[model samples]
Target: DWVTETIVNNGEQYHGLNGDILVWNPVTKRRHELTSMGIRVTKKTLKIQLKMSGQEDFLNLPYHQALLNDEIPLSIGGGIGQSRTYMYLLRTAHLGEVSVTVWPKILKDICAQKNIKVLE
Candidate 1:
């Protein structure tokens, strides 16, 4: 499904999950961060990340507190971009081909110059 492997650091802190990768379409030179799935962080790592990001105050929040107290089960989760997947599967050259979201005229023009059609 036009997937590729890539290494990412601090995924747990940045993505709030582990093992984030880029989804690429080499043929179209298009890419989208389709999903990030990975193991949940332990309390120790979460604390460290919070401190590093100056978000240590988050530890007091119910969700963060639960994580710190190990009240939440360790698990993996992620989000997938449905439109990106549909574009790839349909061999559409641009995201606009599969999505109805408004795009700037300049961007649409640029894509058109590249022979990438955008569905209206």
Candidate 2:
């Protein structure tokens, strides 16, 4: 709600778009970047980001056009996935020990048919 609040308080359409939240891992006794994410940009913020990054031309793209026209929803999305996530969560002996995401359903069926525990 800070974005909304920032608008209400200052009449500015900007949101701080840069920082990230990190996690501390006790096992390694170090901080780790679990994911990267952002509050969906306001039209103004999007313009600023694009301009600053020398990608202002992206504004002409359909996705940006839709956003500026308020046709699509504001979104928040990011994730930590695959081998690294599995490695930390399950403490697998090696990268191959865990499936990062879903395998194809066909693969799952084949593994099942072979009595192999490959999908997890």
Candidate 3:
């Protein structure tokens, strides 16, 4: 899938859920996804997302209405660290101290044990 719009928990932007995990290596000059996430749309989520997109006519349909009425099981899905492009590029061991780094004891312990270096 290419450039598919995704939304999460009434989020503003659709983080890539039903899509591929892309990895772009600037040093190696390559882009790839380690794995692909399958269809992750539930009836409840779909209706909300469609409504947000201003396409609520889908709500009138039986399948769509069933979702809104909570007649179907919610689709359990989401992206796995799909939004961590920068940390991957920098080759950092942890994400706690990069954009808004707040170090926890476990992270500190792991960094110490693994000899992982983080530059502030």
TM-score of 1: 0.45
Poorest 10 consecutive residues by lDDT, candidate 3: 75-84
| lDDT of candidate model 2 versus the reference | 0.60
Over 4 Å off in model 3, which ranges? 1-17, 24-43, 46-83, 101-103, 117-120
Q: What's the ranking of the predictions by TM-score, best on top?
A: 2, 1, 3
Please give the lDDT score at residue 3 for candidate 1. Answer: 17
Write the residue-wise lDDT of candidate 1 on 20-52 in tens digits.
557777658866655555545667777776887
For lDDT, candidate 1 versus 2, the one ahead is: 1
Which whole-number lDDT from 0 to 100 does residue 12 have in model 3?
A: 75
Residue clash pairs of candidate 1: none
Off by over 4 Å in 2: 1-19, 23-31, 37-39, 80-87, 92-120
Model 3 scores a C-alpha lDDT of: 0.58
TM-score of each: 0.45, 0.45, 0.33
User: After best superposition, candidate 2 residue 56: deviation in angstroms?
Assistant: 1.1
Model 2: how large is the Cα RMSD against the reference?
A: 9.4
Better of 2 and 3 by lDDT: 2
Q: CA lDDT of each candidate? A: 0.67, 0.60, 0.58
